[model samples]
Target: MNATRSMLICDDEEELAHELGEYFASLGWHVALAITAEEAIAQLRGGLAPQVLITDLRIGAVDGRQVVAEARALPPALCPALVIIITGHVMHNVTAADLDSDFLYVKPVDPTEVLDDIGSFLAGVAPPPA
Candidate 1:
């Protein structure tokens, strides 16, 4: 991960969220793990404007796609949060043209690669170690 860029690991699965958050935290990202869609929204409401938002496809009642839409519906400045969609063992073939996400990957994703992708777009946001 870039020692720059605030990131959020959003998934209803607590264990999975912690695992991903820990991995990115090791790389020096200011990462927060959210176990529900409401929590994710609360984080944003509390001024945690993450540059990158990583979420699971099937997150309990609120799926990743819906999360993106809700997050985008926030203030204009938060409209284009770079989203990384995570899916299960068998991910649905969703095209980029069909969604407004930066990328999508099936589990188990490589933490290193995820870091690289976030780093690629991090212009100046410093990643604070959690």
Candidate 2:
């Protein structure tokens, strides 16, 4: 993967966001952290284009799905290569049909696993089986 690869992580949990940001940064990725959906949207609108975006499904007032929509609505050149959605809530209300994210993960997920998946994607390799 290119050392300049960048990712955006949006989560209301400050500690988790910071942890993921630091971990990806350590891996030499340009990591951006957003604590709110509004902030995440602002970053995207401000022309911060990341290759990957990982966001919690339920941000304060706006949903992560909204962010996905906004991202997808951007010009082709500005769209993220992948979108991963994370949430602690039950799967009842959330469906892939609604969000159209490349992947969806429940809470308590291993950060390294996420990183590995992302690395594999960027390296043009298939991700290992779960």
| Lowest summed lDDT window (length 10), candidate 2 | 121-130
TM-score of model number 1 = 0.80
* Pairs of colliding residues, candidate 1: 3-127, 4-127
Kindly list the per-residue Cα lDDT of model 1 for residues 1-130, writing each as its tens digit.
Answer: 4565567888877888998898878767778888887788777777777778888878777677777777677775654347888877474577644666778887888877877776675545443435
Best candidate, TM-score: 2
Give per-residue CA lDDT, model 2, range 36-78, as digits (tens): 9999999999998888999999988898998998888888777
TM-score of each: 0.80, 0.88
> Residue 16 of candidate 2: its Cα lDDT?
88
lDDT of each: 0.74, 0.85
In candidate 2, how many Å is residue 41 off? Answer: 0.4
How displaced is residue 73 in candidate 2, in Å? 0.8
